[model samples]
Target: MNVLCSESMKIEEEVSDDSGTAAVHSLPTELLVLIFSWLSVEDLALNVSKVCQRWKDSLYFRTLWCDKELIYENSREDLFIFVLSVAPALKQLSLNPLFCGDPAAIVNAICKGPKDIRKVHYNLSLFPAAVASRILGHYKKYVCELHLEGYANKHSSIYRNLDAELGQMSQLRSLKLSGYFDTKWDKKVLERGCLNLHHLDVSLIQDESDSYKPFLDNVKSHLKTLKLPQFKSNVGVLELVSSCTELKEITLCLDDLRCISTLQSLESLHIRWSDGVLKSKMNRFVRDCPVFGNLKELTLFYIPGLLATAIAKQCNKLETLNLHGITSCANIIKSVPSLQKLCIVDRLSLRMRHIQKLPRYIPNLRHLNVLGSFLNKGIPPKIISQLKQELPELVISSEPFVRYTKRGNKGYFTKCTDSSTDCSSDEA
Candidate 1:
């Protein structure tokens, strides 16, 4: 009876092992489909395709090919061919037209597919409008967001026509056009107006007489955010803010200090200027313009001298302030009392000498981002300890040490031993 029992136990063990193997081999098809959907197009072709016939069969699902952002090169024709075969429901598409061997033909083929394309981004310079128009006419039902970059003067007419067609798409909510512009074409589109536009970004070419006033006036009612690079004049910016009651954010890449006072309702302001330019304009803006009283965030790049002081003194309500590539911002650091966050980037020569001087003015600062040369030496232990003591929540990132410690926490100052070094050693 014992021998018979042992033989039965052996049989049962073997049967259990086989059952486990079978279960492992038979994974649910739905799970496999889900796994493949997460893979990128290139990875799917290279790795997933080698899995087996089951994966290849699962790849046939049209959902896998619906939305794609691809950069085509001559050597990757096989990948493109595979994508064309697999993805049929393509919606949003972005690509570098120059990289494709025959961009016009390839675009036509892709747009011809029965995909519900709603948004498209491309290098406008290389795009052939004849093909684009055809694609748009067919897929106009759901098309909305359009982003065109790298445009030049010659293509202004093309962009105008494209804008006209885009205006027809009732669903279009955002349009970003970057590159050179034609004065006449821009005026035409601005006059016609984009009824559904909520977000618009236009990069002005070197030509100053682009009549931006009309464009600003037209979109002033519906425009939510405006970003202008190298805008030298205050007239256009002032008009834009006064007219666009709904405007929430404005980013100006102007060097003129005079224009800073013109921004009234701007909640967020980003200014990029050289040391001299920043000093002149920032001082004027801080001392003369009270428009920044309501500002929540302010970003300064390469600003020096008394300008930083002016900003800190005037923009008292600013919650976040970012100083980058500034050599002399110590005065500003001493005045901002309500500042909650401070970010310093790529100006080690400036920050190493000036950062410690900041605690007295911005006592309530919670977050700090220190990058570039300053981070190389790591945060001074004394400074870290002082920060922990003053600010309840502190984050410091340096090369040798990246730490987060709360106020009154023990071992917060163990990293840096010298707490008595006078901040006076830091130069102005």
Candidate 2:
């Protein structure tokens, strides 16, 4: 009887140990919440909500929400509920007015819940001017960043109301406005009210006759970054650049290269131009622009010879150079001794003749991207083989064709086993 009791006790202990092991394998609810917090709210609502009821409950936590909110058709209800639940914690909000019928209701809901809201972005294409004005006036105290886009026709009252309401935001730091504005009205609001603005992106709807000098001059001293598609004249560009002594980066879609010469403090430049006449001007602009000497990165689309030469000579410290359909890259590479990464997209044609001319001066070369179907055909196997021998430390990657070799004491090609064989792996 004593031996039977001992055996039964041992069996009970074994069962208890197995149950403990199973409990240890299961993830705790707190750990799951921490993991879900890293995901965007949209992703959580869409994917995690279907996993289980516990996941759905975890999604309601406000800390998981991102600073920027983009709403689409499927997730409209989720966002609406989220806003109502945590309106006070919200700082930045972007709403598609086309999908949202009641802009005033949304604004009121936000104001009632959270008086701390600081930024608001909305598409004003459909909202009446009066409604927009009412919404803007309500949040004027806390709102710092505002983005609005709409047609600037006479019927749209939003433009005038916007100009008026914008003048009242003393804490406003960033403003992005897209549409036409009355010359006198715009000048008055910018000069008198937007004194604290540090970042500005405006698409001028008015003609060149409308002098924007006052607005530009008002914000120039505080402006750190400026992006504009087109500038009317050389004077406007010069005034804009000269005023912004703290300007670190500038992007322009215009063809005129002449503007580059005026921006002395520019550390980064991006441009896209099509016409050959404009391309020639760009070349000249790059050569003359002293700003290129301080530039760390440059992105160009269809830039011509003089500019390419100028970039190589002036941008000695350039770390990244991105060129699209560039015909004169051979000249640029010769000058940029500090270049570490080069991205080239040859849409016109891919011929080894141009690539072979690349200077051997790039000792710090780490990454090279070549686009165009012909790049592979243009480069001979011998040249590729020789490059592999010379640049043993270099990492050569072309989507669907990646070859990596290590730089040993004595240079030699060694196949990299870590490379993926799938063709689609190089999409990035």
Candidate 3:
């Protein structure tokens, strides 16, 4: 703490008025802009803008709009107008329902605003179907990635609208269709929307009907990644997956290897037990998928032991691995020379023995993310420091979850929820 304070003091002194010169104001505008980019929107609006005309000019609100990262909690009413005016520059927009004021206005703005916005994250459980439909309709031609929450339920009116808009999503690439307990995936819309999709996630529905036939039929040749919904069985999508000639990535909660065994083209695989799936025969699953010689990335959630060892032995071309709930490193696994990134976050049994074996197995392992641990004291700093010494190129980090403040600055660090971590597994 004292060291941090001393560093802060030193930084302040370097930019202080010690030389009787207005050094800060005299700096180049380009350098000032680079420094100001680190500040939050609130800082730019309330503090930095008040410094001088030159400073205010350097803060481009339009450039801020390009981020499309919204923070509306306790925000003013005019935020909608501001966002709407600058929606053209944004690539992604996040909406939180707790304080999602002026949804109609913001949606209207984005609908008519830009063709560049490719991603939208709406977290309102009861977001209006009309607004969602309108925005999606407007951005249908260009939007590629879509993540929507709390709308696909039996009771929500947005499902119908979303279903109707499915056909128009011509360029849509990735879809994360998370829903409530009563949500049902309309087979026709699902099939139509998936025609050109490379990545599809529908893991929040109440029931996944065998209607996956048509959906898989349309994208069987084009689909690269598929995430099955909760409570759904592999039997429902097994035959469908069998037909996908170009399938490369698959995330399934059920421990079903037969469904993935035939996909020789698979590059990334994620397996786990779903809430509705019974005892997972992980050993059989791994044994069945020995044909995955082309696999590059593998993720196992709540996985049993022995499976990782099997993967290490078979998928020698593997580059990234994420293992959660793994008790031990299992039997002596062969070295996967191509492995790059490894993440084992929020596990109870991961120890030095498990970590120490990485360098022996994955020679090229570079970025190791052991972030968001709530159950136990995460990987010790001393251990990480020592590992760095042993493998100088290996980058190890233990990060706590951090969110944005109301003022748009980085908020405090805290333990993230399980659902949040699960959602971020792919991106991480």
TM-score of 1: 0.73
Q: Please provide, for model 1 over 1-428, each residue's C-alpha lDDT reduced to its tens digit, 9 standing for 90 to 100.
A: 34334433322222255455443225445555556667788887666767788777666776665555554556776676566566666566665455457675567567655556677776656656676666555655576676766544455544546555665566766667666554343446645644566777664444555434555566777776776655564566565655666666766653544443555667777766633354554555567787678888888876554565566577878888887776656666676778888776754456555666566667787777675645544566667666666665656544443344455656543333333432223210
The lDDT of each candidate is: 0.61, 0.61, 0.62
Where is model 1 poorest over a 10-residue stretch in terms of lDDT?
419-428
- For each candidate, what TM-score against the reference? 0.73, 0.70, 0.71
252-283 per-residue lDDT for model 2 (tens digits): 65454456565677787776664435555555
* Model 3: per-residue Cα lDDT over 11-38, one tens digit each: 2223447666556876656557667657
Give the C-alpha lDDT of model 1: 0.61
Compared with the true structure, model 3 gives a TM-score of 0.71
Residue 420 local lDDT, model 2: 34
lDDT against true structure, model 2 = 0.61
The Cα error of candidate 2 at residue 285, in Å, is: 5.3
| TM-score of model number 2 | 0.70
For candidate 3, the lDDT comes to 0.62
